[model samples]
Target: MTNWNATDLPDLTGRTAIVTGANSGLGIATTEALARAGARVVLAVRDPERGRAAARAVQGSTEVRRLDLADLASVREFAESWTGELDLLINNAGVMAIPESQTKDGFETQFGTNHLGHFALTNLLLPHVTGRVVTVSSGAHRRTKGIRFDNPNLTGEYSPWSAYAQSKLANLLFTLELQRRLAASGSPVRALAAHPGWAATNLQGRSGSAVLNKLMAIGNRFIAQDNHAGALPTLYAATQDLPGASYVGPDGPGEMRGGPALVGRTAAASDPAAAKRLWTLSEELTGVTFPAKVKTPK
Candidate 1:
């Protein structure tokens, strides 16, 4: 995986993929690449017009669908309306270190949108997934200790960076437990995670601090990679024939920017006990449970 790029993607003819937040940033780049490889992609976004605009730029088969991950009702609607096999689910949409806010379900915005949203969506669509589920995590996961189970929403003691970190950590733990369940159920589907080093995107402009946003803008110009480069890890994790629970990131120094490769996570991210606990909490929070057995794709 030294120099793997989007052009290296396998022929995805006849496959179908749903990419959350596919209207912009890494999500759009991923959608373009997959579509170019002959996959029928769905740009699942909160805004249908923007999704359509983005889809128009793509050269292959694509459709736009509304999906507000911040709401459980929307998540259920998106899943319940699904009709056939889903080859890949790219859980790529997320909020960064923005001001503390609650999702429509009243959970912390970062944790809810980044982790719980994908958690619920994944479980709800598990039976239809034939290949893999790729969730986009971040290196910022190292900033926090771990999930705040006692008060996951960080009710009164909320820090934007810390909250974002917790949600990212949750992404890894979710993958671990998801892979475990898939294996135990004798399913061929895999659960994987990826991070886009430091890609320049509009996500930095909404950090809720003018000074921080300006600083990130400067960094975006000089220190970060482009959308295509930043999207490599996600593409690698989604398409490669890697092992379940594999985490992919840039191969550059500090994993900031480079080609995709298997990367290491913190000990907290690798904790099976924490993974199990988080899975239980996620089920309780989302009221979505893993199916007893995932149907094998025929």
Candidate 2:
């Protein structure tokens, strides 16, 4: 809690990390910081060229691998091709406020890529994961009332912002429920969540609204923090001695931009019933159930 920042990261000599969406923004910063700490970082990005460039920009051991969170097959392929123990799995890839669209698997875009995709990737790679699973949620989660399990895809009446809020909320729910299961199974692996607050990232440009993107660009210049600053909370969550289900974010006004600190989530994000329901739904949707060890508590 001493104004944790990237420079404070511990030496990760033998640690290995896989960071999704590592080509730019907070993902790139997280990847670079982890690499600088001596971790062999994998830049899991959708674009191989961009991933390679990003790998070049960083100053430590790094590799590039293609991963499209919107495509579950890509997620499985990445998981299947991995050959060793993983010390960190940073679920950092995501799209925000994008126009209504379905992933290759047909689920709504934001929920599919941000939550379900990471859900499948984490479970498939869970066996390889020896340390932690750090998922990136968003402060936008406060926008929605709660998860609508009955219509999680929002196929009925689609609002981009609403879908994004649900996806971010699902992120926290996934972290909490995953930790419960990991503890029940007596696994050493822990699940944690973090958010970058309002940072200038390519996520805004990909949302498919030119006007909104322009507005956000201007806002980023004036109000948002830089990507490196945004990545601090994630690095803190990944490296800090935090409990399972802990959430980290910036410490600035309204938790928007500053040093890293543990932040609060909406009450709806802590609903155990909703988390369980979403977990079951994720398993069914992805056809990737986590291996059972100790029975889940009733």
Candidate 3:
């Protein structure tokens, strides 16, 4: 298939989009593109100041809202405070290989913030949303053997990379499961997953190893693509009329780094059994059930 990109998006004049971790980097680029295409974008950021500045830099109007992915209560609070229809939701904020930490909810940082937090947020916001959603994942997901249902929090020896990998895989699983539920419930909204390849983002700021951190630091000085270029896949996933549950990444190289292009594939990403297991576990853990009214529109 030819690498797909969205240079001209469908008009989204009256739509409202909420993008998490959108204060800077790829999420900011996604916000810019979405706002430019006519949607009223919300920068869901951890820091309000950074988010406000980011909103100002984007091409279209935007609002800055606080959201700490590590805090379950904050997620619930945000969802509870929100009202009315939501056209797009982009789960874009995440952390990479960092030393072990826990959120306010007592969950491990990587799985807790990256996967569990998003999981709770999406579920809590599900009823109010009436359009498409794009979940940001990573190719590193393929590097993981699979998710550990027994210990998703990595209570054992925690390798930051593996933790990040598992979280990304969760993103894919969440996207697929969400779409299945939407189709089953007859909702018009869609769920899609995307990756930025190897764009230069601040995620590496907290590398677990000094050596790896040094290498990444040196690499960003030359090879890593800009945040704008890295945001393409996410923007495409959020705005395109593509099929639900599809994965988007760079179309160039080993899908390491490039513009917003449809690329990358993983058999594990499409494992129905794994997705269903994750879904069940997620619903149980979050105490949020999928919408039961999914039926095809007449």
Best candidate according to TM-score:
1
Give the CA lDDT, 0 to 100, for residue 249 in model 3: 85
Note the Cα lDDT for every prediction shown.
0.95, 0.91, 0.83
Clashing pairs in 3: 184-294, 185-293, 185-294, 185-295, 186-294, 186-295
Pairs of residues clashing in candidate 2 = none
- Per-residue CA lDDT of model 2 for 22-102, tens digit only, reads 999999999989999999999999999989987998999999998988899999999999988899999999999988999
Worst 10 residues of 3 by lDDT: 289-298
Best by lDDT: 1
Task: State every prediction's TM-score relative to the real structure.
Answer: 0.98, 0.96, 0.93
RMSD of each: 0.9, 2.6, 2.1
Lowest summed-lDDT stretch of 10 residues in model 2? Answer: 289-298
Better of 1 and 2 by lDDT: 1
Candidate 1 global CA lDDT score: 0.95
Predict model 3's lDDT versus the native. Answer: 0.83
Off by over 4 Å in 2: 293-298
Encode model 3's per-residue lDDT on 40-60: one tens digit a residue: 998988899988877877888
Ranking of candidates on lDDT, top first: 1, 2, 3
